[model samples]
Target: MEVSRSMKDIQWLRHRVGQFLCVGFDGLTVPSHVNDLLTTHHVGNIILFSRNVSTTEQLIQLNQELQTIAKQGGQELPLTISADQENGVVRRLPADIPGLPGNMALGATGNAQWALKSGQLTAQLLRHVGINFNLAPVLDVNNNAKNPVIGVRSFADTPDMVADFGEKFIQGLQSQGVIACGKHFPGHGDTTVDSHLQLPTINHGRPRLERVELVPFRRAIEAGVDALMTAHVVFPAIEPKPIAATLSRRVLTDLLRQELGFNGLIITDCLEMNAVANTVGVGRGAVMALQAGADMVLVSHRLDRQLDALASIVQAVETGELSQDRIDDAYQRVANLKKARLTSNRRVRPWAQLIEETRTLQHDLAEHAVTKLRWESPLPPSVRRVAVLVDERVPVMVAAGDNHSPVLLADALQAVRPDLHSTVFRFPETLQQVRTDDLLAQLRQYDFVLIGINGGENKDYLEFVHQVHAQSILNVTLLLRSPYDAHLVPQSTNLLALYENTPWMAEAAVAAMFGGTADGALPVRIP
Candidate 1:
């Protein structure tokens, strides 16, 4: 029943408990605190974000130094370096990294082959940078149009299509030796709230859950997925009382482990998230997650919180509050996963070659994902002047954990029309009354106007679009973020849905607007 050797052989089980804690720090290199966590606290895993990465060479060095620190700390196994490189809108890598058309775009293509290629390319890029695990291929079926977090992250609205793409993606990841994890298990797609801000609850009964939420997870497991990350949203249908799935025994152990038959590692979402932190404190929540059946507890963000969570778990085991058998089970799974996936032979491919390959794949996928909602007519041949307008504030959701970057919409359009005039309106404050009038007056002189819409909430921007249409100018509205906004806008002619605001998506959309082909269909419903 015991995994490896008995407790008598090891000097201290406290170090073994540290393996369960995966922490994040804020820098391009390992800070003093993170180094202590690895050397003294014996933490064995790390999660990287945009703040921790700059260039490919720098990131590779950081990861290598991380492994060296773990080994010097007397740890026996190679550290598991993980990231949220989901490639679409949630990408954590630098701008130069391939920002593939994400999930919904791939779903729009309706070709599983693209999903397979996406997974392979993503794995190649991650492994090249020393990342051994990818928190990607979002299996959540985005059926809710108002879902703030998972709109373009999910593959499709239906379970079968999600499963088909998810399975292919898993195969692609595992083929390249990087572990793929299907995330926000039991579905975070049906809710309107972002779990990073507060917890949301799903009321769907068991049958509906089995049909929709659990389908992709089941398929991922069958495809030999190495891990699954838990969602913090409450599912009252499964658990008697209100509890987030991350800390619910019925959800993590009874349902995910027993009923679903998933033997892979079960990892919790960040304990620092408000969904867990606001309810049951981070340290206490970490203890509860392990006891409830999670193989690894993520306390991504604060060093103090990570140490506290690790200390809490050790105390729970020592005080008999958490059984040693549970600790052993979780540790064994983590160790087995490392042994199977982590290798010393991981070679970093040439940065330029990897970038070229990934961009090539992204360009092809973007062409297939750009959907032309409506295209009435092309611009008149005699047009001498054109105006391009885009929002200055791109909506970077809290859930996105985005390090702000420039949107290339105007740049992409300017490449085609060298004489095009571009405007970037500021958000919240709205364009000043004088500035708005000046912009509209300028729009009247241009032969064509191009407007960018981000989720369609800006009333002032919408009003400006209407004024331009009223002037009878040839204009095209670009749906930059949400696909549902295609119906919400008053003027619906020549609307292009790009779903995401990434640079690659922007270029593909601009190409489609000017005589280029965009054959993608809508994967989700507007109504």
Candidate 2:
């Protein structure tokens, strides 16, 4: 294929030397605009999010169409298709698909083998759906429990634990020819707010960062991570610019590229995140990110901004504000990543086989992580009746119309112990309306009381657990959502951190209640 250099080709030549192209598809369908963009711009890659995905079949069709579009555009290169499949809340594919357990659950197992299996299984599923890159196995050591965005998304609170898991995860993914990206570089685990809504600042000194925040990232880089996704947070102590890492050359270039010796692709977190969009126009953010050493700018949410950004970058090269060498460096990195994908031998494992393997691992890990936090008396081998309490504070379900209670937990418990009678009580309504005498009367009838805190800050669930504990009922609290609620059951003996209310976790919890395995230690310290 002879590559021509017309005005459009010349623009491509200028941008292609060091720039990456971002193309957006409309759901699972490849729109004309995307086709035109790929043909005209020779865009380097595509990123898929939940909005772009509906089913595995649709995703595979979309990717095949994208490749056909690129080939017709006179670009003979294989495009890198990436997705954020961090399991749990960040899963791009449907839940019914062979999704691995969330990072926190994997971390709780305290076994690198499980982490490796998770990465391999995730890669297998992604590869079958035509995704070459997984922006996953989040390397962030979420030390801060209050961190709104990266709580259960992170593997653990300690850097050593996260690093160990992340290293094995990278190995497993790469072994399967799936490029694993260690994300939110420099760290997003310590922030108290979501960067998608606002720019967060981390005030830790450089030494502190090297010790705690940067440990997992450094380990991941050492393990040969294919890419590092920059965070949107600012570290005021390290850089005086007060800009997010995505736009700060001091952070991306000086710290990540130079200091860390990371020769792999430096990708940015979503440009549509509030940290970038609120500070600078999306187009400008793209340009600045490239200038800051980001090899691939992820403008996943804003196409117009991406187009403008590409234009600005091309102009900058022409005007000599950005050097051709820097452009070439970035372009080479992206091209190399694509080349690596081409050389990789990715084969689709049977979905049934993958699911069975993943399910067994998830069950084993969950069994190990179920901590017996509080138990006043010996757990009765047989319970005639059970009263279930579900927390109403947090949004348990993802979509708008879904109910936010732990009804599944009640069902699973009943399935396991058929003889035990189960009654569910929603909060406020049960607290304000249901008489204490009646509740006590009901509690007296049941041999055990199992409290499932839906989701919330530690104190709210803690107070609820404490009240249940005070009643001298056979108290067993199951945290169906966040481990943050584990702090409240300090004195209770039967506490289990099921991480999330997924069916796998719930099923595992039921088995653990029947004495499956010894409860594991809490990976994160309950504060």
Candidate 3:
């Protein structure tokens, strides 16, 4: 029987190469190209995105299939299935899933315990869905007001605030046996450009970076975070070159490894992003990233790009351009992480009840984070004839597959004040289509005007807000994404930054408007 079992063992899988390539599957069903990568190369880790998800059942089946395929191919250790479940904007989980308020909401609550609960709850949900790794707890200190990407996704503006929440989040996730990866290492927080679109350069010197950007990363490391994801931004202060952090050995090996002393696996942000790919293509970028000490290269989105990246890395190894020792070291590090973090047997819970419990926690965070920015005169107006105008740019998440939740301020306010008479105005479908004269006339009908701006970076939204401000209408601005938008609004505007337009958060913010309890500290300073 022993001889027969030995004979039945798979052969091709045992010789699996390119352990550094941590690629993502294509879509809802695993494509042939993806399977070929997993089977031929024995790629151990697979990241999931929203496009790949439809329902929980499908996701669970996909995860099982991927793992079974790995096992069948003779790749021993369990394949690490990871997802971006950092609720609020980065959530890949289905809309029905218990999406927690984002990091900024957690930060605004000013409670470490809540953040810990968020992490633990998020881990439990992902584990149930057969996911072992969660790329979450965005540890970047969002100090820049003009930052396009790391808005409400970040916890706070200050290093200490982000550190406290991030550490607790790591502790909570790891305690439940889910690997927590602190993301966008060396900080992508202060960039005006989105890394997905292009390479953002951070001009902060060592002292400035140490004071803000590196603070949360260091804290996350000290708290024993299992993984650190690299940012694609160029740190001129550290590297003095145009090379992204993903490709800079000086940034990754010297700064992060030597100075910060991070021993955990260092994963690169998606190589498919324009920042890296545009400069050197995803294939070359992957090799460069691995050479720069990245243990895993995430080539997400395009399967062709992913395969090309894997082939490039393999070639680099074969040519001695990337030493075998480096490959082995990365493999060992990733293997150790998988062995420690992957749950041999996950504890099953009543799915319905678990979601319910998580939803309760979400409510707690939203209520506590609903802060009162200005409390001068009569708040929660005695006469509630409210008018809400939402920016046309505020995306409906269900349709866009984006993390941003739609602005439901009108509904939330109506929920809080049952007798309140309110109407919501929307911008036209096309850009610059909303009739300014008609909008102003409609606003003039209401006692108090409420303008909703979604990400706050759109010039049209800002233009509208300025136009409204010019009218001398008693309108208060509600920033639905980041509080930093308050900087762009008129100084006289009574802005209420909800951080996220999540349902519970919208309700909580509206409650404050109607005198419920506008009760959170400003996480980021607004000019």
- The local lDDT score (0 to 100) that residue 50 gets in candidate 1 is 85
lDDT of 3 by residue, 101-219 (tens): 88888888888899899988898889888888899878888888777788788888899999999999999899889999998889988988888888899987899998999999999
Model 2 RMSD vs true structure: 3.4
- The better-scoring model by lDDT among 2 and 3 is 3
- Residue pairs with backbone overlap in model 3: 371-520, 372-518, 380-514, 380-515
Candidate 3 wrongly placed segments (more than 4 Å): 1-18, 377-385, 394-407, 414-421, 428-441, 455-476, 491-494
Local accuracy of candidate 2 as per-residue lDDT tens digits, 330-404: 888988887886555655677788778777766676677665555446566866777787766665332111424
Ranking by TM-score: 1, 2, 3
- Measured over all alpha carbons after superposition, the RMSD of each candidate to the real structure, in angstroms, is 3.2, 3.4, 4.1
Q: What TM-score would each prediction reach against the true structure?
A: 0.94, 0.90, 0.89
Query: How does candidate 3 fare on TM-score?
Result: 0.89
Report the error of model 2 at residue 506, Å.
1.7
Residue 454 alpha-carbon offset, candidate 2, angstroms: 3.3
lDDT for residue 422 in candidate 1, whole number 0-100 = 63
Best by lDDT: 1
> lDDT, candidate 2, residue 378?
55
